[model samples]
Target: MTVSDQENLLHTSSYYAASANDKSMRSELIGEQSCDVCIVGAGFTGISTALHLAEQGLSVIVVEGSRIGFGASGRNGGQLVNSYSRDIDFIKHHYGDVVGEQMAAMAFEGQRIIRERVATYQIDCDLKEGAIFAACNNKQFNELKEKKALWEAHGHDQLTLLSASSIQEHIGTGRYAGGLLDHWGGHVHPLNLVLGEAKAFESLGGVIYEASEVTKVTEGEVCQVTTAKGVVSAKQVVVAGNAYLTGILPDVEKKAMPCGTQVIATEPLTPEQQQAILPSDHCVEDCNYLLDYYRLSGDGRLIYGGGTTYGAREPDRVESLIVPKMLKTFPALQGVKIDYAWTGNFLLTLRRLPQVGRIGKNLYYAQGYSGHGVTSTHLMGKVLADALQGDTERFDVFAGLPQYPFPGGRMLRVPYTAVGAAYYAFRDKLGI
Candidate 1:
């Protein structure tokens, strides 16, 4: 199937969509529009940037290809954890201690930003506290130990180490040896968060249009963004589309490869079963490259996600594959039926670092947060908005990270990534 078809399939199944607070009646772009800043993609990155810019008194316009929160922002595992995909040691060794220290500070700050937004905006998105990184083996256990130490070295005291027995008490699963729990890291109903930000942006006088796919972009002193029905000419354009950003910006797409990840939600569990599965209501993730991440929803459902496909295509047996994985974690759920199965695309960069930089003079883009976009995307929105407002210090810090073009361009890169992902899947199976 084509990318468009795949996106249509993926966006149509999210459980969050079924329970959204309000259905977006936003219209498509029409005629001509003008704003100080025009943002592409109405997911977290775009809406957050619009909200920040509008708060700064800038005339901001956002054009989303579909309804608000239809992208990975809304359809993710919703684990708002602090920590980048890249390790702190990697940052320290490559960028020196000073830069690494700054990045470390920003890591925790990302978590704080999400909490502040939820509280400030009074977003009732089923916010929960605490998250755990469960280790399946000794290597992962050691990694968690080092991570706990690293957090303490950075003056973060919210992380606690749980032994195997304690982990079982917290997560009912004996598959993990031990884990690191963070009080600061938590989960939220991501779709509601995105919608809350959208409403906040509107309240701050921002303009947002749905079903407005940018077909062409003309760059010059002022950038011209042409959608299906309208053109937005602005002094600056921010591309925050992540993996689903098709042809709007070729330069941005080259550095990040889109991969489809599947998720499934089981029928609501009884209170007894919910407590048996995740007693503490904390989100949990394993320590593999292709890891299982699951959490209990506010409605007592088990929302589990894993299994990645390189290309933008839905898995053949989303529920069939994931139901077993979910059962593996909780054998007691052998009879629990899956209520929903869905998929979404997330961008993966060559360096595994987020790609944030300027294209030409006034065109800015940010993508490739890997799977760590939940909190990082919010931080990125503030950074991009600050850069647009002439404070490029923080934004430039991340923009300095290097990104490489996919080896074989758009068409061949899918298969190329498939080959690479197969290797990682093998490693994950081998527990390496």
Candidate 2:
């Protein structure tokens, strides 16, 4: 999904697009410019970085190909779940306690940063707290138990486990055996959140150029970033395009594959219907390998999403794919009209973790957040800003992650990964 109004990019008719607070496109770059740091992409990662850097009294410039929050940042499920996509348990088991603990220390920093920015800058994105992790089977419920314990060991103790008898309080349906509640987890109007942050950055004297796609980036004592109509020179450059950063940085882009996820928003529900479906108004995500996440929007619409399409191809009809899933979760809403349906892409890495590192000494990038871009992207911005200011301690935690291309190369990667995911999906269906 992109900002189709401006540039030639096609915008998905998503609920977020319809509800976004800002629709005006910014001026495009048409002349040479210089800054302390030039960043590519104006989504969460880029705007977050610019906001952090500007707060530190740095002259930062953000250049976007389409419009701010045009990519996944605008099209996400809007859940503010903490931690990385793979979770700290996975990182600790594979990397070791020294680095694992270090990663854990920053697990919840993203949500904290978002909350601080919202209150400090007075951003209005319909923010809310509380999230539920529903378990479809006993196997997944057991995993949730371990996840809660692991997170507690890492300094977070906001989770409370639920039994089958008590699951209905947060989730109305009987589809879950048990679940876990993250008191700190929450949701937001993602597009509005990014737009607010972009405005906040501008208030701090940060410059942003829309419809200015970066064509080339040269690493040197003074980095040079070239767009269609202008060039920006800076001491450092940050590539925050995520899945959209294709040809500009082939090596980094190759390390992740773009995958599309779909979501549907139903017509506003009656107050009683909303109360029946989500008693506590908490966002709920099931523990299926291919999971389903649903929540009640500020206007009482049932926003439901699930299913994945590798290679970032939009489905012929998102409602067709998600409607059945929503019905299975809440059969009482069978007759509800679906008002909006759309699909958006997220970068998935081989290791299911973020890929971050720098080329030479001045060019840096962070992407491949899997399905956890909402929170991880914000944390990456802070980590990136710190690194640019001569603190590489947190930066090294991500940069030290091993990078590998898809096992079967670009031609066969999609099919091979699909086959592997199909196996796990089969087990999920069998309640294994």
Candidate 3:
């Protein structure tokens, strides 16, 4: 199918919308506006930052091109797994033990912040505990074991190493050789989390305007963001648009590329079938470079996610591609029906680290979480807010990392990324 057709096919099947607690429609930006901070993109990064700023008693205005939670933040697999694409060894090798330890400690803090906010705000997002990193081969199993040791050495005691038998006991899948369980990392309804945070921000006297496509961003003493129907001039501007961020900032667009990931949810399983498939109700992700992440929803639906498209378009048969992978993990679900399918874009940077830094003296931007945005984005929001309030220590650590621009310009970026991803896909297939 074409890109537009794929987007339409996928977006129409959001389980979160049917069960979302907050369904109120926010007003679009239609007039002149000004605030202390003007945020672009209303996904987790934007909403979380706005909420943090509002809590600090700062005037904040968020302008979203589409509705809130319409981006990856709303459509992800909802796995709140810790750690980024790069491993702890990578950080230690590049940034020394002291900084690396600090970064590792900060990584787990994201999960803590999410749990605290959920309770403090009383947001109902179907929060759950436990996440498993299942290994597809012995090599990956050894890697997980090494990671468990490393995490323990770094003062993280929440991770438990599970042997093959123990892994089967938890996931009911014999395909994995072994796994690691993180009690702190779990799942939640992503849309509800974003919307709940948006409500909390509004309650704190923050302004949010949807359908406000930012067309022009002119930087000056006070950066001006121009939407089709409104304009926002603020002392500070934050470009939290991630992959969907286009035209607002060319420099950020150059540093990261958008890749599409798809997901499908099966019809509710019988209690017997659900118990057979996943007894513990924990999120599961394999250790492949092109990985498969899945979880059983609160309503007993099997939410499976896999198969990425490097280009803008999604696959013609997303359900067909992903269902086979899901069935491989649980062959008993041979005749299960797929009830929903969707796709969303995620931002990836060359460094595989989140890019957080200031554009000018007052203008800042944060994006490129590389598929670990759910928890990291929330932590980033706090860091960004603290920076705006003159606490730059934590934010500077992330900004100190290096990032490479996409080799080709916008016209050739998709094709270039396709070539690069093809290499990784081949490697994953070979288990290299």
Candidate 4:
């Protein structure tokens, strides 16, 4: 499908949307509204930030263009991998040791935030523990060994490197040279998790309006955000739309490019089949730039996802794009029927690190998580909330990092990223 086709969707026809728990539709913004904070988007970043701010006694109003979790937050591969998309070594090499150390110390905070919310809110998103990074080549295997040591130096001790033979104990496939097991990394039912967080935010007196697409923003001490049918005047404004941000904020649009990703869900496997695939019940993602990530759902379906179209165009059919890759990893399931398939977009920055800063004095924004929104968004929600309350220490850690607009700016970033990705993918294929 074309980018225009995907852009017009309220939500993908994916397994998560089909199985979503909140069947009730939220009210839309129909008239003038006012609040302490007016957030534009009800995905994880918006919902989590609202929950945190409301807990701090701020009146919060969240406005989503579509439904809550209707973007990448709900549609992503549910793996809860910690740290930035660019790892610590990359951070240190590019940004230097001071910023890298700060990033490392806070790398695992997002996972902790997720676990705490799941338990505290009693969210039943099929939360599970443990995730594996499968290495397809010896070079990737050696990098995993080095990564473990680097993580250990940063005080992460729950990582274990498995040899090729030992990898079979965790994963039932022989496609991996070895794997890195992260006890803290895991998976969850992403849509349900975000929906539950929205409910939690509501319980804290936070307000949310679905289908209230923000069309314009007038920045001032009290920012005014206008939707199609209503206007929101607030003490502060937050633009958390990520890939779905569209052109609502021009400054933000320049810093990141949206890219499409595809996923497929197989028919529920038998208990025996489940054991034969992921025996340890751990989510798995490979070590390539263009990587495959898969995990078993609560009902035993293989929730497999991968493939990226740099220009954010949907695949003609999700199954056609991802099923062959799934079959390659587990050829035993060659004939297994795919139950559902869908495509979603994620914001990719040139640096691959999430961008968090202000559009103006009273307006705060966070996006460009690359594919690491699962963890980074939650961590950022807290930081954004804290910064709103006059504590910018943690927030500065991110805002201080240089923000480089895509080399050719918004119009050309997509093709530029596509070319860069093709190069890395080729290197991965060549096992260099």
Best by TM-score: 2
Candidate 2 backbone collisions, by pair: none
Q: Which rank order by TM-score, best down to worst?
A: 2, 4, 1, 3
- What would the TM-scores of all predictions be? 0.95, 0.98, 0.95, 0.97
Worst 10-residue stretch by lDDT in candidate 2? 1-10
- Pairing residues by index, what is the TM-score of model 2? 0.98
lDDT tens digits, residues 1-432, model 3? 358634422334578766678777678788798899999988899988899899889999999877788889988999998877676788889878877877887877778888988998998888999999998878899999899888788777999898989998888778988999998889999999998888888999999887677898877899999987889999999889998888777877788878889898989999988888888999999998889999988899999998778744777878878988998999999999998888888988877889887877888999999889999899999999898889999989888887778777767777887887789878877777
Give the distance in Å from residue 287's predicted Cα in candidate 1 to where it truly belongs. 0.4
Q: What number of clashing residue pairs does each candidate have, in the order they appear?
A: 0, 0, 0, 0
lDDT order of candidates, top first: 2, 4, 1, 3
Q: What's the C-alpha lDDT at position 358 in model 1?
A: 89
Error of 1 at 79 (Å): 0.4
- lDDT (Cα atoms) of all candidates against the true structure: 0.86, 0.91, 0.86, 0.90
Which residue ranges in model 4 land beyond 4 Å of their true spot? Answer: 1-10
> By the lDDT metric, which is better: model 1 or model 4?
4
lDDT digits (tens) for residues 1-432 of candidate 4 = 457534543567888988888867789899999999999999989998999999888999999888899889989999999889999999999989999999998898999999999999999899999999999999999999998999889988999899999999988889999989999999999999999999999999989998777899889988999987999999999899999897787877888889999999999999998999899999999999999999999889999999899868877888888999999988888889899998889999989999989867889999999999989999999999999989988899999888889888867888888899999999999999
Q: How big is the positional error of residue 170 in model 4, measured in Å on the Cα after superposition?
A: 1.3
Higher lDDT: candidate 1 or 3?
1
> Model 3 lDDT vs. the true structure?
0.86
Instruction: For residues 189-297, write the lDDT of model 2, one tens digit per residue.
Output: 8999999999999999999998888899999999999987899999999999998887988888878899999999999999999989998988988998899999988
lDDT of 1 by residue, 190-307 (tens): 9988999898899888888887778988878999999767999999999888988888777778878888788898899999999888999999999888889999888989999998
**Cα RMSD to native, each candidate?**
2.3, 1.8, 2.7, 2.1
